[model samples]
Target: MDIIRIDDPRDPRVAAYLDIRERDLVGRHGRFVAEGKVVLDVLFSAGRFAVESVLVLENRLAGLESTLRKAAPALPVYVASGEIIDRIAGFHMHRGILAIGNRGAGQPAESLLATLPAGALVVVLVGIANHDNMGSIFRNAAAFGADAVLMDATCCDPLYRKAIRVSVGAALKVPFASFGDAGHITALLDRLGFGQFALSPRGETDIRDAQRTDRLALYLGTEGEGLPEALLSRLRTVRIAMAQGFDSLNVAAASAIALHHFSRGG
Candidate 1:
């Protein structure tokens, strides 16, 4: 495979890769950085996003020769020693694989929701700002056959490097879009004829006992505060039965159990 050797970290060709942690904070405009071999595999194979460029530690290139082959022949793949790569990234990259992906104009939530087939299962997230929780939720959504993930504006970007890495590349595979406020999302789901289920300890029915409709939207909110009382009371609320007094599960774990139960389609 043809490779470009980057001995200098500051070279203009590799500038997009510089100070990744800082860039992630300020946002990448329309671009996202994908790291690790697994994420790179998804970035190349998924076709959901356009790959801008690839930067790899020199020794890691041989192992990725086949994967890199999937890229357009003219695509630039920069190889650099570990030291140079570390200097550019502003942190140690143990996985030593990085690539920039551009998603362009993201699909509208309404457009994505309108395309689901009968028996669609989509996860709706609200006020979930933690990257790990966001990633875990997507991972579960992918694992359990969720058709799409719709998030409110309060949720963190799923394309963030840490979230994508935590999701084991599911972030790139599962289609997602951030919509407006909780009220707007709820109204749209209602308009789409989706049976909305808000998960909360105060829910009237146990999740195991909840019936899945042809179109179901499971709503998950941030930990501690959980879903809003107004929403919980209005929607068909369901709860994961827990032991006495202790009614807590990480939002991600809770989503898995709930998603798994409904995915079975009893």
Candidate 2:
């Protein structure tokens, strides 16, 4: 890797990393920010996206020598002082690791879905815009070995810096694609030979009783509104049994329990 020293926060070479907290919200155009050492490891090994470049705090570079060695020789690695990095990122630099990952051209939802093997486990999300929930869901999906994650267009980006950080970088490891809407997704899942289940408090089958098929799609909804009545009415619904007065679990917890059941044949 080419080592470049960035002494000035306003250097054009690092424009992509400027005002990270603000730019993260407006968006980075085709790029996404990934923070922390763990996410940097995933960015290189997962092969889910191309890395643009890397910026490291001066003191932390030695500790990351092995990890940064995975980079292509031509990749630019910019090292800066902690104070300079803090100015560049517009925040404190406690983690001392950052990278710019290109989105690349995203694969279409149907194309991604078509590639799943028989007996694949998939998690489907609808209207889940909360970054924390999105991160936790990806973490659960990876933990349970779900083959992929699918979400409607209403969901948030898994690549958002905080979401990726919160996921402990699982968002980069898991293969995922977003669809236009719930109805289109339903049709696609059916046409693709998946037996789909909508998980909710009023589901008809207990998650334990729901049998896995050659391909399974587990649908989860937003935190507050939950799944729409129409979705619940048209699909096979499932519930996680809980003690009295509790009807549901946080989507992440529910996904863990439900995915564990399918993955381990509980």
lDDT of 2 by residue, 107-153 (tens): 87889988899788889999989899899999888888899998888
Model 2 per-residue lDDT at 231? 82
Q: Over the stretch 82-181, how does candidate 1's per-residue lDDT look in tens digits?
A: 9999999999988789999997798889999888988899999889999999999988998898999998888899999999999988899899998887
Which residue runs of candidate 1 sit more than 4 Å off their true CA positions?
Answer: 264-266
Which stretches of candidate 2 lie above 4 Å from their native place? Answer: 264-266
- Cα lDDT over the full model 1: 0.89
The CA-based lDDT of model 2 is what?
A: 0.88
Clashing pairs in 1: none
